[model samples]
Target: MRTAYSVETVRAAERELMDRLPDGALMRRAAAGLAATAVRMLGWVYGARVLLLVGGGDNGGDALLAGALLARRGAAVTAVLLSPDRAHPGGLAALRAAGGSAGPAAAVSGRALVADLVLDGITGIGGSGGLRPEAAELLARLEARRPGAAEPAVLAVDLPSGVDADTGEVPGAAVRATATATFGAYKPGLLVDPGRQRAGTVRLVDIGLGPHLPPQPDLLALQHSDVARLLPLPSPESDKYRRGVVGVAAGSARYPGAAVLAVGGALRGGAGAVRYAGHAAEGVVAAHPETLVSGGAPREAGRVQSWVVGPGLGTGAEAERAVAQVLEADVPVLVDADGLRFLDPGQVRARRAPTLLTPHAGEAAALLDVAREAVESERLVSVRELARRYGATVLLKGSTTLVASGGRPVRVNPTGTGWLATAGSGDVLSGLAGSLLAAGLDALDAASVGAYLHGLAARLAPEPCTAVEVAAALPSAWQQVRATAGTD
Candidate 1:
């Protein structure tokens, strides 16, 4: 798992570490790591062009010292001091003593710092909001002056300039780095969207702050091994009844394929049996012969460990009846697709069993009575709010899928791909998650693990395939996750 720490938590940890170490020791360690990465990115340090966009405080110190190191290695390093007077004294002195050029942004020749790399140390974790006018102007000139279509690679020190290290929000202009080398631990902004876009590739460089940091994290991203631990595996004595049965109430005459895809995903989700009760029984049976189909609502579907409601079942009277029946089942229930439209918040809030609501941004916005853009931009806030309001776990699906339940840190899914975006794909996810619910996982676990597998399967499947192909790929993804657990 990848854990992210808040800025306040990071600052407290850094202070503790600094108290035990000698003065200037921490900066040197950070500088060395940054310089080593820059060296690798440049390939050969000799005769390379290394430009440092230096600014105030420790971030500037790290960049300036790194520039000095590159200069000593025969690289022609130039430092464009954004804050000429406020630049780190020791760092600038070292750069000058090492035969590197240090001056205001105007003095730096941008006739194309042509080629190697540009280091952004304009701001660190402490800075907030947008970039200063002077800094922004200098960066614009630098970008415009780059030699025709072959601009130098930009590496940000810590996080990219102008990104909120804690909230992952970018209020204004921000630096877009080719890669960001963050020290100590990962920050929340580096893992989530707008900020995620600007961060590009993120590399964590340890500065020995692990021991001083808190055990819990602000955010968590699961790896293959983590997913493997959560997956259900059968024993020698296991039977169809023992593994657990998933009840799906979905599809209608108008859109029978929804039932087919839902059943397909559930079968691949390791459910012992999939009992599908809906108006599209024939279509489901034709697609997945193994499914046990019934032409009735969930109330008459006999016994089931968990229920998956919605997914192509239109917002009609019959669909409402099925949704109400599933809600009264006294077992975990997953709400998705058209079911989310007529969902009763009071009923969900009153349920003693776990309930998971899977909503795309548009659906979530309708639930909250807000704009879709609001939910998309502030996904973490929206998901948590929905979970609180409905008294259920909520999975807000988008570029960064977030799973949140009351009083728990949101689990940011790291495995999603653009290819997963297609018609009927969401229906498949609903069934897969419902199966996990029946398999005895909690609402949060089921949703997160289901999303992980759903995304991994999409990436593994052949491009431009239908939702059926993505669902079929689940077994292999599950096996691959389990098979690679030992390595992790």
Candidate 2:
């Protein structure tokens, strides 16, 4: 698993490590790593043109010192200091000694701005809101250069400038780095989007802060091995009923396709059996004859370990009654799509069994009573808030999917492509997660693993594939994840 720490926690750990080391040792370690990455990016460093966008503080120092190292290796390096007076004295001296030149941004030559590589040392984790006007203008100028071969590879010092390190929010113009060399630990901003999209390829450089950091993390991303260990594989004695049953209450007369897709997802979600109830039973049975179908509401659908409610069920009186009845069941339940519209927060909060809510940005905004734009921008905050408000786990689906529960570190889904934005994807995810819940995984694990597999399934399918193809790819995705852990 990959863990990300908050700025406050990272700072405390850095302070402790710095105290134990010699003066400037921490900076030296960071500089060495940054320089190494630059070396790999440049291939042959000799005769390479390197431009450093130096500012004040340790961020600029890392760039300057790294440039100094490159200069000594026969690269032509120039530092364009944004804060001339506040530049790191030691770094500037080192660069000059190593044959690197430094000057104010105004004095910078056009050739320098269009160098082969541009190191953006403008701001690191401490910055918030956006970039200053002067810096933004300078970046704009760099961006305006001719496309294709003339474009420079921009490498950010710690993180991309003008992005919130804690929240992943890009309030204004931010640097779009070709790659980012982040030190010590991964920040929440680097894993979540808007900031995530801005930070191109991120490389974490360990400065030995692990021992000093806290055990708890602000965010976590499950790797293949982690998911493999959590998978509920059956034993030799296991039978269909023993594995667990997942009940799905979905679809309407107007939209029966939703039920078919949901059932398809549940059938592939490693569940022993799937019991489907409500209006679309005939459609579901036609699509997947193996499914146990009932024509009545969820209450009459026989016993199930967990229930998935509200995909394609219209927001009418019948849908409301179905949702209410499912919520009344004394079993883990997943609420999604149309079910979310008819949700009673009080009823959800009062449920004895675990409840997981999957909502896209628009749905989350409606639930939170905020603008859709607000939820998209502040996904981390919005997901956490929604979970706390309803006292249920939430999976906020977007470019970067997030799963959050109270007092737990938010889990970010890392395996997804832009192609996942297609219709019915969320419905498939709802059924998959509900199946995991029935298999005895807790709400958090179910939501996280379900999303992990769902995204991976999309990636495994061919390009431009529909949501049905994504569902068809689940078994392959599951096998791949298990293979990573050397399991069958």
Candidate 3:
């Protein structure tokens, strides 16, 4: 698992490490790593033209020192200081000592400076509310790509400039790095969206802060091995009932295909049996003949280990009654799509069994009584808030899917492609997670693993594939994860 610490936590860790190390040792280590990455990106550092955007903070110090290292290696490096007076004295001296050039931000305006790589050290983890106007203009002039000319690979020091390290929020104009060399540890901003999209390829540079950091992180991103360990495997004595059955209450007369897709997802989600009860039973049975189908509310369905409610279920009184009845079930329940519309915080809070709510940005906005834009901009905050409000695990689906539960690090799904934005994707995810719940995984693991597999399935399926094809690719994805853990 890849863990991310908040800025406060990271700062504490950095402070602890700095106390033990000699003066200037940590900065030197960071500069070496940054210089190494720059060397790799430039292919050959000897003749490379490197540009450094320097600010006043330690972030700029790291860039200046790194520029000095590159200069000693025969590269032509220039440090353009945004804060000329406040530049790191030690770093500026080192750059000049190594025969590198240094000048003010104004030096970049009219010059058609051609560089192989640009290092953005204008701001670091503490920066917020976007770049300063002068710095932003300098960055714009340097980064503007000419017609048919190759763009310089921009490398950000530590956290990208103008991003909220704790929240991953890009308040205003921020540097879009082609790659980021994050020192010490991964920040939440590098993994969550808006900030995540701006961050290209991310490489972690170990400055030995692991032992000083907290045992618990603010965020967790599961890897293949972690997912493999969580996946339930059948024993020799296991039977269909022992493996668990998932009950799906979804679809409506107006949209029966939702039920079919949900059932398909459930069938492939490692559950031994799938019992579906809703208005679209006939259509579900037609699509998946093995499904145990019945025309009734979820309560009338046979006992199930878990229940998935609300995909295409409408917002009318009938749908409301169905959602309410499913919530009344003793088993773990996953509420999604139309089901989320009828959610009563009081009822959800009062539930004895675990409840998982999967809502896209729009649905989450409606639930939170905020604009969809608000939820999208603050997904980490939104997911955590939703979980706290309803006392249920909330999965906020988007470019970066997040699963948040109380007192646990929010899980950011690392596996996914933009192609997952297709219709019925969430419905399939709801069923898959519900099945995992039935198979004895907790709400958090279920949602995270379900999303991981769902996204991987989409990638495995042909491009622009329908939701049905994504469902069909689940087994392959499951096998691949298992294989990664040597379980296959």
Q: Residue 316 of candidate 1: its Cα lDDT? A: 89
The numbered model that scores best in lDDT is 2
Global lDDT of model 3: 0.92
lDDT of 3 by residue, 304-371 (tens): 99999999999899999999999999889999999999998999999999999999999999999999
- The lDDT values for all models are 0.89, 0.92, 0.92
Model 2 lowest lDDT segment of ten: 479-488
Q: What is the alpha-carbon lDDT for the whole of candidate 1?
A: 0.89
TM-score of each: 0.96, 0.98, 0.98
Query: For residues 116-199, could you state the per-residue lDDT of candidate 1 as single tens digits?
Result: 799999999888997989888877776785336567889999999999898677887889999898999999888887688899
Per-residue C-alpha lDDT of model 2 across residues 1-488, encoded as one tens digit per residue? 88999999999999999999999999999999999989888788999999999889799999999999999999999999999999999999999999999999888766678788999999889988799998998898888786575787888998999989999999998999989999989999999999999889999998999999899999999999989988899999999888889999999998898898998988888789999998898889989999999999889999999999999999999899999999999999999999999877888899999999999999999999999999999999999999999999999999999999999999999998999999998889988999998888999999999999999999999998788999999999999998876531
Q: Which runs of model 3 end up more than 4 angstroms from their true locations?
A: 109-112, 486-488
Clashing pairs in 1: none
Instruction: Say which prediction, candidate 2 or candidate 3, comes out ahead on lDDT.
Output: 2
Error of 2 at 359 (Å): 0.1
